[model samples]
Target: MPDRNSAAHRAMAAAVARMPDPVSYQETALLETDLVAAFGTCRAVAVSSGTAAITTALAACGIGEGHEVLLPAVTVVMTVAAVAACGARPVFVDSAADGRGMDLNDLAAKTGPATRAVVAVHLAGRTDGIHDLAAYTRATGLRLIEDACQAQGTTSGGRQAGTIGDMGCFSLKDGKLLACGEGGYLLTDNTDLAARAAAYRTHWQSDAPDAPAGTHLGVNFRLAEPLAALARHHLTRFPEALAQRREQAAALHRAVDGTPGLEPITAAAGEEPNGYAALWRLTLPDPRAFAARLAQAGVPNSTGTHRLTAAHLHPACSRFASGDLPHARVTVDALLAVPFTEHDTDEAIHRRALTIRREAVRWTR
Candidate 1:
């Protein structure tokens, strides 16, 4: 639980005082402006949810029927649902063996005539092969959309995660970095696309009351005011929070460094990742048993709990999956998320890490 006397709480209280008008108010506009400044994007649009942000990104980029969008096989079902909502077919790409990125080889092999775009998800705020994917998308002229919902402040190659793609979507759900309880936003550098997304956020209502009808068909996905206030306050604390998480992550990494069957997951070279969660890969033969042992030892851990399930395995997305997903299947099975939070003390993190190492060694032995 968050402290009631914290800075974020004070900001929230101020927001509540200024509320009753969420849409056309100071907080909303201020949040939008602050986001654009923070992410170095040309524009920002607050929306109802992360899913809405993705859907808006798809629609704003002109992804529609008969088009194909390539996404990682191991992703949340929401990403697939966003594609389906746009009436575009999703082509499930395999994950890389290390679980930090999409398998570039599989991504290249899956490209075809109808492939209009690629949605690159930054799993747990850890970066992937952005430079390679950016080059690939440019050479092929395919639009790139980043699903950085779990990666609010992640960056790579001197650029932010959401800004690297043609459009980027973020989530502000309960457990997200910038928790607004339930809200999301989009980032983009393209002016025209930004206009489209802004229009879509408000049901395509004309900017000018005197103008003819709406310029494009749209949906009601506007982010309310109170949540924006909470997000804004959390945004202010992001720098400090991110730094703390990095320290915690480093501690966890050191804890498992000499462990026989546990290792910290990593991003690509030169990519500075924003710590979202502490994740590890198990080399032991029975990861399920390891997870159980950790739980029994009072250190709850899980494989495929946070986000390891493959989207292709879900019925909603099965229609789009084809061929073998060897890497995706393997990565999902091996990775485990160790519970971590920004508020956790150094003592707590070290204890949890020790539990992980001790249980892992016992299990493997």
Candidate 2:
């Protein structure tokens, strides 16, 4: 938390200082253009927040009453809530037994006649497991919605995570890469899908004077101009910043590798990560004590968010899931993310990390 404000952020602040009022800002258009240029489509539309991004995308896709939305059971409630808000059911798929994204087996099993869409969440910034999910969506004839909100720089093979799905939603939340306090975007290569989502965020406007009633039902999910400007500036620096995040994560891997009682997610060559630390989640017997110990050691770290149990944990669990699934439990066994503040390299921060892990290593030993 201490280093959340970093040199990269200060650089951005300086640039923002010279900017005009956010309401009339031009960065919104520029960032959208940059996003389109990088992703190869104008289907990219910015919105107010990640939840709004997911909900707007859901609304645009025509998912509502009587639909069953399949998503990771271990995800934040927002994914399920978005579906429920549309008067649909939220079915859950646990992470693969290997522990990455949603399990294909559950996805296959839960998808039925009422299943209209699947929200494929890319946990952390890694997307190695999404290819098969994409294939599943294709085979089932279900619409694929990639939740790459936590996966800004993630990809499968050479293709970026969002591009492979029928439509993808990304959040530029405070903890995300290229964050703009709270902002989001929906991406796709499909033109009709693009038009539908664009109209879903605003008060309904189309070039055609005879635009459908679809435009009239939108909420105020629009991104503010100031946020868009910062997002635009940050987008320009993302390619370079991404390289640094990879560097930071690698350093942590080296500093803490093979430490007793710790299980790090192994990175494969084909599955390059987005170079961030919303990962490094370890499994320990007593998570609370371990987290406390790490804090006492002066290592900057904390738990990753968006974890949930079966809706049984809440009265509404029955509404979205039959029971709590395995990964939700697997996720609780001491998941912690190393600090990835942009200003400092992992080299500058690794000693404290090693010291913390070495201390915690005893519990595993």
In order, the Cα lDDT scores of the candidates are 0.79, 0.70
For each candidate, give its TM-score against the true structure. Answer: 0.86, 0.83
> Which residue pairs of candidate 1 clash?
none
Clashing residue pairs for model 2: 245-275, 246-275, 311-317
Q: Over the stretch 50-112, how does candidate 1's per-residue lDDT look in tens digits?
A: 999999999888899999999998788889999999999999998877676788888999899
In model 2, state the lDDT of residue 197: 69
Candidate 2: segments with Cα more than 4 A from true spot:
1-26, 207-216, 278-283, 287-289, 292-319, 331-334, 344-348, 362-365
In each prediction, how many residue pairs overlap at the backbone (N, C-alpha, C within less than 3 A)? 0, 3
The prediction achieving the highest TM-score against the true structure is: 1
Off by over 4 Å in 1: 1-24, 97-100, 207-215, 292-304
In model 2, the Cα lDDT at residue 317 comes to: 58
Which 10 consecutive residues of model 1 have the lowest summed lDDT?
206-215
